[model samples]
Target chain A: MRSSYDVIIVGAGPGGSITAKTCAQAGLEVLLIEKRQEIGDPVRCAEGVGKEGLIHHIEPDSRWIAAELKGSMIFAPDGTEIKMSEEASSQKAGFNLERKIFDRVLAQQAAMAGADVMVKTRATGLLRSNGSISGIKVMYMGEVTEIKASIVIGADGVESKVGRWGGIDTSLKPVDINTCTQFLVSNIDAGEYNKFYIGEKYAPGGYLWLFPKGEHTANLGLGILGSKCGTVRPISLLHKFMETYMPQGKIIEMVVGGVPVSGPIKQTVANGLILVGDAARQSDPLTGGGIINAMDAGKIAGEVCIKAKEKGDYSVKILKEYEDRWRATIGKELSKSLMIKNLLIKVSDEQLNQLAHSLSGIDTSKMALPKVLPILFKKNPKILWELRTLFI
Target chain B: MSVIVNRYKCGYCGACVGVCPAGALELVETWIEVDNTCTSCGVCAKICPVGALVVIK
Candidate 1:
């Protein structure tokens, strides 16, 4: 690796790879680093992405897709199911992907775009120049190497410290943190629509989910609020779902991870430093969906960073454009999702049961949240009044 | 006391390491290391995504 570059992105996930690809394609020297020996091994995500947000950026690749989905089923604690209408769910078509393969392909694209790529290179800390980031200190091939850059993109995952190291307060409230565990089980019944289960019994302060990867395979997972999940382990909750829902399922693989269901932080850019993906908490606060948003931020940041490089200014003033562009892009929806997540977790299971009952009688698959939420809680005026921010 | 890691279950995503108040848990890309500073507060165990870290209180 060269001693320095124009951009060095930590973590070769979709966000990092895309940033590297976009900037390198613009003729900037870029380097992408992955801590794992393989680019996308030990996949920790549910691997679901919407086609509307994804297809425009990445072409349809059969090698990375496991299943295409039309809609989803929302189940309440009482086993009542609300099948989203095909049209509504079709508005945002979904896909269950092989993230391990998908991530590697994105990284390879970055390399093809002229970015240097390295696996098993761990970023240990930031290199500070006058209280701002000048480069990164990474353990590459078991040797500490200081690589300098005009810009650094922290595409690290949810537990990323690069934001913290860059003077951004990345602290999360317990309610904002979700402890997630999943099992990829095979030889079970899989369906076209994804399924979601909500209740304290399933996942306190969160929900349980099943996204089908194939005809007889699915990724079953649950996330619970860190504060609400006192003494309750996510694995036990996942196993309970296995026993109660799919007793015949055979375990194929296991993944454990955290999702920052919180909204984006106060700021994502500092002097010569920008945060992307989970590092920036760009994931949807309600569904923990992030791949598209992360890539969105990466694409925007690449453009803004290139502008800054061309002008020979890497200060916070120049970098703030990334934050502005991202906010104008997907930031509003993410903030709304945070509000929705907070309200859902605060409500009781009985209310959720009532919601399921109400929805079961109507066709809500095509309706958006503003149109659907009021009906879901029509009986509870107090709750609706409290959530007026979303509707009104 | 420090937290114990279950090799069979840990995904090594480092959620426990990030939440450690004592700064005792470290994820070195391959293995998790617990230092002598651990007070066994069990925050790491509670915050562990996979239930791999355990505090034997």
Candidate 2:
């Protein structure tokens, strides 16, 4: 790789690769780095991305699509199922993805756009000159090397060290992080729609999800509040959940990771550096899904970086524009979703059953997840009184 | 760098120390701790099995 580049992005996941691709396409030299030996190995996510989110970045590739989902079934603790239509589940589109293939395709797009792709390269430290970031020091196959850049994008996930190294406070609270574990199970009977089970018995402070990948394979997972379930491993809980709900299925793959249930970080940009994707806490507070938001941020940041390079100014003041644009577009929805997450955590199993029963008969033809708030208030006027505090 | 393990949330799984590349993390008396000369990479905070370790900003 050259001694320096116009931009260097840490982490070659969907966010970093997309950012690199966009910047390179704009004629800025870009360098993309990944710590893993492979671009998308040891998958950390549930491998499910909504159809609407994927379309915003690029056209859907057939090779990346695992299955097309129609809708979602919400199950109460009492087993009362509320099936929302596909149109209702996604205000736009939906799908289960083959994440490994999808992530690799994104990196390949970046490479094709003229960005230097470096794998097995771990960013060990940030290069600072007089309190300003100039580049990053990386260990490539056990050899330490430094690559300078005009701008650095921290696309690293939930445990992002790049942000911290750049002086951005990206810490998550215990109650705000979801301990997630999943299994890719085969031979499971599931529908075209995804399934979500809610209850303390199944997953406390979170829910269990089943996103069917094919006729016999599905991504089965659950995320629970880390503070509530002590001494119970998330993997063990997932196994118990499968035993209770999908006993006959065979496990094809097991994965564990954390999902930031909090909204975006207070600050996402600093002098010569920007944070994207999970590093910026861009995942949905309710769903713990971030592929779309990450891609959106990547596109915006890429555009901003190009502008900054033209002006020869990589100051925080210039980078702040990206933050303003992203927040103006998706920040409101993320904040609203976080409010819903906090409220959902306070709800008891009995209350969930009651709410599920009350909404079981409602017309979900044009419903959104937030639309259920009004119905929740109608069933229990007390919730309306309590939720008033949230609205204000 | 201080690894603050919320006593209430930590499950003591030792996954944080396991994933640490700098060898700066260790379990002390059932609680995870970070030693001096730490890099503050946030790997422990990221890999903490229970979301217990919050790297103090």
Candidate 3:
């Protein structure tokens, strides 16, 4: 890499790659780096993305679209299922992707847009000049080099150190993060609909998910709240779950990760620095889905960054535009999701069973969270009274 | 007491780094490094999805 660039983006995930593509296409000098030699090997996510949010940035390709889900089924601990309506779940209607290929394609798009792509280049610390964040200190092939930049974007996933080096707290408590483990299993009856299981018996503070990846194979995973984890880790819990649920299935691969369910951090920008994707905790607090939010934030950051370059100003004032724009869009929903997640954790398994029973009579074709939550709140007011704040 | 990491099993997902209250864990792309700041509280061990970490006295 050269001694300097207009923008240096850390991490080559959806967020970083999109930002790089946008900025490079806008004629800015951009360098995007990935710590790994490969962009997306050993996938850390469940690889699901909503079609609408995804198509907003890039067209779908069969090479990476593993499965198209019709809807999702939520199973309470008692085995009562709540099937989301086609239209309602259509909001979530999307594809299970092969992230190994998907992430590479995104980075390739960035390169095509004229951004420099470097792999196996890890950012070890931030470069500060005269009390202003200027660039990054990176280690490549065991040689550390300082690359200067007017702006740095931390798109570096959940174990993000870039944010910390730039003085953004970015720390997560045990209760705020989910320790997740997933397995790719074959020889099972995988369906078009994704399945979710909830309650302590399944995941305690989190939930279990089965996302089919076509051809009788599926990604089965569960996340447990870090605080709730005991002698049994998520991997062990997942194995036990598999024994009871998909005994016929044979495990093929394993992936482990942590999702920040803490919503967005208080601040995502420091002078001359910005954070995106999981680095900024942009993932959904309820669903742990961040690809869309990350891309959305990256788009906004790109715009703000372009404006900053044009004005010849790279200060917090210019970067705060990104913070405001993302907060106006993704932030509001994330806040609501956080409240919901907290409520879900507080509600007992018995209450969840009751909720499943109370909603059983509703027509599945018309069932949506907006409609179902109100009915649930009305029926279980004693337990769900806190939900009033969300609707109100 | 300190934390031990099973390098072979670590996916380097950084789940342990995020939950380390002492900020003792660092993800080095290929592996996780536990620093002296670790109190051996075993929080990272508990949260390691692959069970790759342990608190050893």
Candidate 4:
């Protein structure tokens, strides 16, 4: 690998790949490195994203789309199933991806866009020059090497070290982080609907999910509030869930990771560096969804980084524009999601059942959080005083 | 050489299972099991998010 480049993107996940593709297409020397020997093996994501937002950025590829979703069902502890059909699924109509293949295709796209991609190459630490971030020190094939860049994009993920190394405050409180576990099971009837289960029993301070991949196959997963998981572990809870629901199913794959679900961090950029995807805590606080958001952040960072490159100045001033642009896209929604998530956790199971039962008939597909209260308050206007912020 | 997981401390996020180069580690509902195929390269222990997996060389 060359010892230097115009841009160095750490992590070849969707976010990093998108940034690399955009930047390389703009005619910059880009190097994208991944720690894994393979680009997308040992996938950690559940791989559900909105078609509207994602299709707006990239074309659909059948090789990676595991299942085309038509709708979603949210199950409350009391067995109330709130269905949002495709016609009404404004924000949820999308696809369940074979992330192992999906993530690979993205990195391949980056390579096709003229970015040099490397696997099994780990960024050991950040490289510095003149007291500012420049590139990264990488280890590959048992050798340590320094690579310089005009800008570095860290899409490293939930426990992102890039931000901390580059002086950005990326620390997430336990309450903001969701510890997740996923299992790919076969020989089960998953149907086409993506399902989400809420209640402390299924997921303490979090939720459980089933993203169907194909006929009789599904990705079963759950995320628990990091702070709330004291003696309770995700596996124990998931085991019980499976025993109760899919006792005959067989697990084919398993993964574990954390999703930053509170909101964007205080800052995602610093001199000569930018953070995107989970690194910036860009995942939705309500659903812990981030595939599309990461791609959006990547596109913005790619464009802004190109501008910074041409100007020959990679200061925080220029990099801050990336943050501003990112925030403009999904900042408010994420903040609101965080608020809703916090409030939901405080809600009793009875309230969730009531809320689910109330909206189970709504014709709305997207079912935006703000619209929930008007219907909810109509049924029980007495508690509206305390939970008024949810409507706002 | 092999990998071991302390079930009590293990959050069972499957980080070790995901990183195991040999595909010898699997997280069953009860615990993380290290099978006969394990080469014990220690990648699992290194990548354990909760520091539950330990490698005894």
DockQ of each: 0.48, 0.10, 0.71, 0.09
> A324, model 1: CA deviation in Å?
1.7
Instruction: Write down the lDDT that model 4 would get.
Output: 0.79
Tens-digit per-residue lDDT, A183-287, candidate 3: 999999888778889999899889999999998999999998887886767888899999987899999999999999998689999888999999999999888
Pairs of colliding residues, candidate 2: none
- TM-score ranking of the models: 3, 1, 2, 4
The segments of candidate 1 whose C-alpha lies over 4 angstroms from its true place after superposition are A85-92, A368-371, A377-380, B21-25, B35-41, B55-57
Model 2 Cα lDDT, one tens digit per residue, A141-212: 679999999899999877677887888776665676777777889987867878899878788788889998
Candidate 2 accuracy as lDDT: 0.79
User: Which ten residues in a row are the worst by lDDT in model 3 chain A?
Assistant: A84-93
lDDT of 4 by residue, A212-292 (tens): 998999999988876675466666677789999999989987777777786867888888899989888899998889988
lDDT of 4 at A199: 87
Q: What lDDT is reached at residue A242 by model 3?
A: 90
Query: TM-scores for chain A, candidates in order?
Result: 0.96, 0.95, 0.97, 0.95
Model 4, span B1-57: residue lDDT tens = 887788877765444553454656654334676888888776555434455777878
* Candidate 3: C-alpha lDDT: 0.88
**Candidate topping DockQ:** 3
Expressed as tens digits, the lDDT of each residue in A225-320 for candidate 1 is 877655787888899879977899999898888888878778999998999998898988898888999999999989988998899999988999
Second chain TM-score, each model? 0.89, 0.76, 0.91, 0.88
CA deviation > 4 Å runs, candidate 4: A86-92, A364-373, A377-392, B1-57
Q: Each prediction's TM-score against the native?
A: 0.94, 0.87, 0.96, 0.86
Task: For model 2, give the interface RMSD.
Answer: 8.2
TM-score of chain A of 2: 0.95
